[model samples]
Target: MSEKKSSLIPKSALTKAWLVWETFPQTCYNYERMMGQAVAQVFSCVIYYLYKNNPEKRKEAMKREIEFFNVHVEFGACIIGMAIALEEQKSEGKNIPGEFITNLKTSLMGPLAGMGDTIWQGVVIPILLAICIDLARSGNGNVWGAIIYTVLILAGAYALSYINFMFGYRAGSEAIMDFLEKGILNKLIKGASVMGCMVMGGLIVNYVSAVCGLEIVSSAQTYSIQTNFLDAVCPKILPLGATMLIYYLMSKKRWSSLKIIALIIVTGIVGGLTGILTY
Candidate 1:
């Protein structure tokens, strides 16, 4: 029986991998390949490490990883990390079947993609955009807003990938996912969703605007139905309600984005024509 190795993937090797990791989303996107080439690009070093003395084995391993891969790019590190360990084992002639590598990746990427969506889109981008919107409120063409968002996004993206890579690298495989399935990832996602809701609420209040043009005149007085009635009752309720309606339609009813937007536009036009909506 072969003894298990105890050495870590070197920092320098990881740094090289990280460079490919950061750029793959932009450089390797394709309808057919879909980050498959990017996966090959990033993990080439790992395969090289495993087959440094065997050119034919290295070429086959390189070809192996290039098969179609699709996932939210943020989760690539974890997948790559797992691949690294397996490739290393294979290099040591540990008799790990090639099917195990491909099968695990195919099964694993789906969950990681879900997490990546929640983390990268639902939470990270929204929070950053909200912050940038705050800066743009200063009304100076939002140059600073652009600058800040760019810097923060780049930094955040790199940092996020780095942390996930390190964690996945250290954990070595699906063992971490076993712990993740016990509701840890779920709770984190839920907490992030709560925070995302708060930010989204703030965004709706600040960005979404709606008004009722209806007004009633009584003995030398006028009252706007929107400002006097709705706003007085619950500030910004129209925008808030509209936001919630869209949320319900999309989440519960499974409405498409285009369909929801069309509904809103159609409602606005009909309401404007019928005097239901006011400027």
Candidate 2:
């Protein structure tokens, strides 16, 4: 490939493409194509610039990008950047196969999605939420907590997107392959999972409140089941048990969130009326 053709994709075009991706990555999201249309949308300008002289090639390039794609939004920027690089090479008259690009995208999306979800959803969000929840509680549910969380989340998302996108563009598939080969991605996922579990445990202990109201009254004296029995056996056992039960219902029984919520409401009402539970 000639040097000029290699540099056909100007930086300005890439900036615009990134903006497009950030703004409307899922505007046409559907089961049929998932994020395919958005991928094509992100590259519309770049593709046009690369293949303006050849209408047939331009159409083919657009069609190539608009294939089935689904990945985590933040980390998916890396894939988009790689796709742009591949498109540039193809435009430079290199012998890059369309199928190769498609297959690469398909293969990378799953692993990246797993990593993205684990790190962002599992670790980062939970920690941030734990802090923000505490802040809100301390402030009696003030909007400052919400506002701070919102600002931090938006800033973090955009920053990660830009960094990953730039890295992928400059480093290409080789860098990602190196990370995978070295098991770095796996370590990150595992670490994030552990951190997520720890944060959740803390949240449960602090947030979850379940008190036993049951008491046994005898001729001589009254026995407080909660204080004398449950507390003696385990502190915060009810909260822990409740959390585990909910987790089991969701994970093992495949119960929907709405269904579980309904169950909680019913249980709360029944337990309160029967005087078996409080708080």
The 0-to-1 C-alpha lDDT of every candidate, in the order given, reads 0.77, 0.86
lDDT (tens digit, per residue) of candidate 1 on 1-279: 122243545667766886787766546578887877888888875565666678998788877888777777666577776677777777777788888888777877777777778878887898889889789778767689989999999888888888776666656666656756787778777887787788788889888887888889899899889888998899999999999899999999999999998999999999899887867
TM-score of every prediction relative to native: 0.83, 0.93
Off by over 4 Å in 2: 1-6, 219-221
Off by over 4 Å in 1: 1-11, 26-33, 245-279
In terms of lDDT, model 1 sits at: 0.77
Candidate 2 lDDT score at position 119: 89
RMSD to the true structure for each prediction, in A, is 3.4, 2.4
Best by TM-score: 2
Q: Report the alpha-carbon TM-score of model 2 versus the true structure.
A: 0.93
Give the Å shift of residue 73 in candidate 1.
2.2
